[model samples]
Target: MTISESPHEEEPLVASIDVGTTSSRVILFNKLGQEVSKHQIEYSTSASKQKFASGGARRFSVDSAGGGSAGSAGSAGSGAASPSAARQAQQPIFSAEGIAIEANEFLEIEDLERPTNPTLTFPRPGWVECDPVAILAHVVQCFAANLITMDKINGDRVSRSLLPYRVRCVGIANMRETTLVWSKATGKPIVDYGIVWNDTRTTGIVTEKRNSTPQALQDSLRAKTGLPLYSTYFSCSKLRWLLDNEPAVSEAYEQGDLMFGTVDVWLLYHLTANHAFVSDVTNASRTGFMNLDTLDYDDELLKYWNISRDKINLPKIVSSSQYYGDFTVPQCIKPNLTSVAWTLLTDFCSRSPPVPIQGCLGDQSASLVGQMAFKPGAAKCTYGTGCFLLYNTGTKKLISSHGALTTFGYWFPHLENPEHSQPHFALEGSVAVAGAVVQWLRDNLRLIPKAEDIGPLASRVADSGGVVFVPAFSGLFAPYWDASARATIMGMSQHTTASHLARAAVEGVCFQARAILKAMSSDAAGEGQKDRDFLEEVVDETYEKSPLSVLAVDGGMSKSKEVMQIQADILGPCVKVRTSTTSECTALGAAIAAAMAYEKREDRVLWEDLKDVKKWIRYGGVEQGAKSQDGSAPSKSCTYKSQSLDTDRRRKWRLWEAAIDRCKGWMDIVEEGTGAASNSAVKSM
Candidate 1:
């Protein structure tokens, strides 16, 4: 079955709430993991651009590293400004230096500290933020909207069935590392807006931690937690930044009224009426304070960050697929939660029981699960506002030798032991900008009317014509891990045209993804050889074959046939690409977790084994010259079969590599008010 096709028959459904960078969406899935119904609500818009400015989509692709998307180029930071103000704020200059904006020129920020509505604002260069209130409101609105959508689609299946009872369970997947805090008593946001995952505002904090601490301690930070201290990309630093910068938050912390969490904790608190104060293992792992081995907040690590215990309320860590709790219908609705909308959600739930939101995952990890990468060797990439490639290492906790990160893939404690119920670890490589680069072409450069126009625009020219664009916009993630690098467009000549520039930008994303895949493969090979000295049977996954052998893909930008084809050609080697044509794998993964929770609660088995999940999901792949286990033709899918030669791939890589050298170290970024960057051994790539 296709994404547009859904069965209206009597079938139980699970729901997933996807909180991305640009929008919040809800999707209902049957047991087959096919979308039954869904609804999406985009967050806010940014200021318009001049003829040579940037994208109007208001994307914030920071080093904040959203769980799934481009910072998730998402977040509910939707604020519409005056036309004049929008035009005035943008000061686009084509300088001899290749940067889009001068460092001083980007200081024309508006009063985006607080917003009454859904508004996305950029307070500084390389920073993206959203109003916390708007974040919750949009999420609830998506849920409410999905309720209406399901009823209309379900038809006779629902005989006056209240929304709470329409679905058995729900799951939530959101951008990772996007930090939020609120008053525990009033349930109101603490800061003016929540710090988006990609916001690099906390870069100063990262520099301080790495510099002040002894070299030995700095080295062990990654040993204890499979993450490197790159920039302000996690929750702990953002929380600390708030405590120091926002006096109100510091006062609240002292007064014992502060509650800090990622987007997951914020949503769970509101959804369950502030009852479910829990963060799943996946979300908790993203916070720098969480110990990767213990899967809980570490006191020493917290002390390193100066996070006091028994002062602020942190969410209790839980399994990714456990029954956290059931949602509670709020008795009173605020302006954010309207009476009519709440009424649309449930009166039946208020009278009886609310729907159980049992599954939770970070966006990228959820995409892995949604793609059914249950095996350790499997991997998937999400080409959202930011692109993330997560390689499943099963129970093996293989850390990246390259700049890539090691993280908890997913933890399904509800599943039987036969499926290996421990938390899965992964090696992750992230490109801070993907689709946002395209948005730059649309809203800023005005090269095209829509984001999709890049495909046709690129096809206008046979190739990039030797032009190369390296978008190190938010520094670089994954193997390079360079934080000082700014964007650079190299190789442009007198012969270059708009089509050449457009195609080069598209190729930039593909090349970045390729770099990550190569790094992941290198790491996997090293781990396989090293771990064999201590362990056995660890060679079955990526170590046994090539890393990223079968990359399951999803996200907003993955829909482009041109983009996928470019990715295949650049990949060069023989690889099978399974594109999630539905582009909702992140939501599907969350729903699957919810389904697992529901099944465990009812003592029923959804699949004979967890490995069979991909088959039930509405996925059919088209493989060229490939046969099934039973020697039958492979299932049909929107897959790309590449005839890319090694020489061509190398040439593209060399072009990108040259541009990267020119772009790196363009900015000497330092955290404000804490210390100078000179004191630290920070690599500002």
Candidate 2:
């Protein structure tokens, strides 16, 4: 049966909570994909020494290698005998002492401009961590703030007697592979800090596993997990590290009180009042333990890690767009601190019932859904702290011959039969450092006061002035999964200025995205499907005419027209970069998944009605000079057609490529020496 043409319906408003790597947000969207209200809280990673009540002080030391400190926090200590040593002595260590749990209202999205939230603390090189409980508290706070904002907006339209808009469902989109282990009974974190996705401390764990396992076994693992054996990007390696290094974690596991989860599961568990402990297929795909084919934890992979399934609590895998559980307001939010929004939300829930969390997706997959890139070969690039380039491969799970990960895109249970749903798949290329380079520029180099100043500073220079910044700070991901790679700025001359460095940093992000796109295209070509002809057509149209294959972009960095234009240029004339008019596409995607599931639940006829591939053609109406709802199309995106001749682009890309090569093998070379200077050089690079 066909569904109605109107985008709006009686379906209630849906909310999405996006727990990102660098920040957390709660956004509410209507049926037509318009955001009603949003609240955001920014946070960062840290590498500080900690003293536990049970365990004594644990020191995290980074042997200073040389030139300067490696991270943004250490850039000021450049003149010291050893930058790492100097910074280490001055760095504030977060102790388990005097830690208090308090609920801070999530600020409106506009408040994000006030000042940068100091989230990440780099106490030592290659160590990135966050307080998991603090992160969860921020998520709750954002939801409360969003509800308050909604009430303020609704109160203006409706009488005080009437209730504000009700949230019928919630969808969660979270940063994947950031591992956390908490107690199943008490819900307290076993470890004080969460090992962030970009943390490379587990490189030794990955190396040990790879070395211990036979070549054939490693090959089998790659075949099963659809990931290479080198990098520490997955959860299993992080979990392994925790199991070996943290006595608390090991003891908890032995006592059978340990529960493991990626960020999504942690959020879901808290939101549902510890009743629902589950993960969606999209989040499960990145764990490095799930079998790509079976969509379940692989026995052999678990055996390799020496972790028994019964020993620890693992989240149950569920469909991405199905009702998981209901949300319960935590006791921490006292009425005295509650805003009108919270009161309105609680009143609505009391009158009706708690809304179900109907959908969930890993952040990158949700971005793809947000862009409506449902067709095979359709792609997107999200520029957050790191860049994630995802190409939808539709129903087929084409394993990447290249380094890209084969991941579950999304899964919505069939309305009539929940057991028979097929999951969509995508090819993902993760760039370890994207917008984080800008953070380094602002915090470490003191080049710009804010990240937004990057574009203006970069625009002051016509080009990078031969400078190329390869931001492999935590090492390169995808295609080249080198954990030992370090950040490098090459081609600098006496003429180089801050402007040149800023421009180079932006270009570095763009160039890396281009490399991933190239790899994605190559992988798509290798698929040997009918979609190849469509891809060929898109490529042909891009070069011959103005319409290139469109790349729907989102995230903080996508706001920079200069960066987006650079992305278009580096991707060649065949690729058109399109940024969402609304910055909340990631949240909106999660909302869309929830809304779709809600509609399906209400009417089976509407379940897959929107699945028609043609519907996505309207995505980014800015393409081909298409006018938006208003007479003139809004400057939603600043599409920069390839202005440089092919030769010039190639020559520039080659220089950048050379810089990447130079950045490699530095980690290996430094590890051979035990000197503080060598350690400092590695950290400072």
Candidate 3:
């Protein structure tokens, strides 16, 4: 991903912030949704810039009540949207030790922002833990980098007027289920590490929760929350794990000082300086607490998880395309910019929050929207650290009988007619490990020199040559949600070579996608039959959805021609992702949502194209961009229109299922190899 600065131009641009598993990225997009300029700082690649994290010298915006405007050094932005922006919001200002809790008395803001190589740490073989502080720090640095770029691009315009911030709006997309708990009193982490979405630490916890709950209640939870009680991937399991295991967190929880949030909530809370504490529908769906139908937190689900909203500051759930809060600059980093640029930013923050963070979506949902999968039957699959397949379900929620998840596609509430505003839903399938298997071959097996080399190496082999690689490193997820499963390679023989292993590794990902697509087809087919009557009555084209006909694909693994080809050949429908579309889809989706929200808030469409949902989703408005999807634009996408014969596909499917059976209940063996990643975080701090 060329997340590097591009030549500046004179146009209003929206900004997208993506906080992923290993890195944080910020990209600027014009009204056309084309990348204008970008900056990325992988946690492992950057050094600590604590000075900027604290906005320099542990500075606090004391509010207008403190004898200064929101822009004053001792105060922060006090807009109605920003809680910390006002003096009253900053109550109980003293630390437990009686010192005013401006900075040092609370979290080690400097140490927390420190960079560490190999950002994610393995606490146990199957357990993954990441420093929550480090995550926040690295993201702050990412924002600082982008703010500097903004100064460069608009430096000339700034001298004339700061009336309109060139960076018009902000959108956030994050690893949805990674969970964190911190203190509201001091705003410090209750635990040493955050339980990442892919972390398997909650396996035992989930099993216990399932065993204790009655079958009917379990079924009810699944039906409402759209997440299985036994799934370890959701945030509920993480929050439960801490409550049951971590004494400090338990104590904090009981004391009413604890707060739980996914990465999105955490980002919203801190970025807004404690002003906005909420999650969009997409992120909230993964929290395992929100009701799938109502798009609000379910009381039963909360009671089941033992999460007392009164005690713990659970983030309020909101729509994906709505103004949740304004973004106050993280004055912690003094970016390498001129005094004039810094002054301009200071001025912007003072006049009001620099930008309104009006949009947010889970990464996968953002990808789905970015792919313009607006109508039912439209679907998108993201092949990132893991693979996620999401199928749009329109306003209807089709509870998946298969292992796929029923979640939000995106929530765009009506601006003029609140009743007209409704959520678009999706059925999702998850593969716990995808690109990581390729990384395994590169870093662990040393079978390939680089990640990109795997594609070429795999292309050398005709097929897996009877080998089947089950990349259930932390157990299987979606369509076969087995947390006890372990990684296994079956059917290997003396004829096997590194190339063959490469082929198997890449095919493994495709095979998983095939499984999900098959399951989704089954689930969606049933819904199609059930909704025939509904479809007959509906006039809107958005409601016309069935099983995914053409699967849109993206992410790092999608770049591998061989991988894409194998995926295309296996799935019934075609696989397509545009050349400039893979890496940028998630960010672009967030940008679109932001623009949509801005349009609604302003009570007018931004451009003629945006007046139509189809055209708006297609072109991201009328602004012509380098990303034009017209016939003239060259396509790097690979498509396999014809599926392999049913007999052959069945044979491969059987082989994959058999391999999955062989790896069940092997987490115990895997646990011995992984060390605590939190320990490294502690040392860095």
lDDT-based ranking? 1, 2, 3
List residue ranges in candidate 3 displaced over 4 A.
1-10, 45-119, 155-165, 330-344, 351-354, 415-420, 528-546, 573-582, 599-638, 643-646, 667-685
Model 3's alpha-carbon lDDT is 0.66
Worst 10-residue lDDT window, candidate 1: 65-74
lDDT of 2 at 11: 33
TM-score for each candidate, following the candidate numbering: 0.81, 0.81, 0.78
Residue range 650-670, candidate 1, lDDT tens digits: 887888888887777767633
Q: Please write out the lDDT profile of model 2 over residues 223-320, one tens digit for every residue.
A: 88877766888898899899999999999999999999998898888777446899998998788889888888988888888888989899998888
> Could you report the Cα RMSD, in angstroms, for every candidate shown?
8.7, 9.7, 12.2
Off by over 4 Å in 1: 1-10, 46-115, 158-165, 331-340, 351-353, 528-545, 598-609, 619-636, 669-685
How many clashes does the backbone of model 3 have? 19
What would the TM-score be for candidate 2 when compared with the true structure? 0.81
TM-score of 1: 0.81
Best by TM-score: 1
Question: Between candidates 1 and 3, which one is better according to lDDT?
Answer: 1
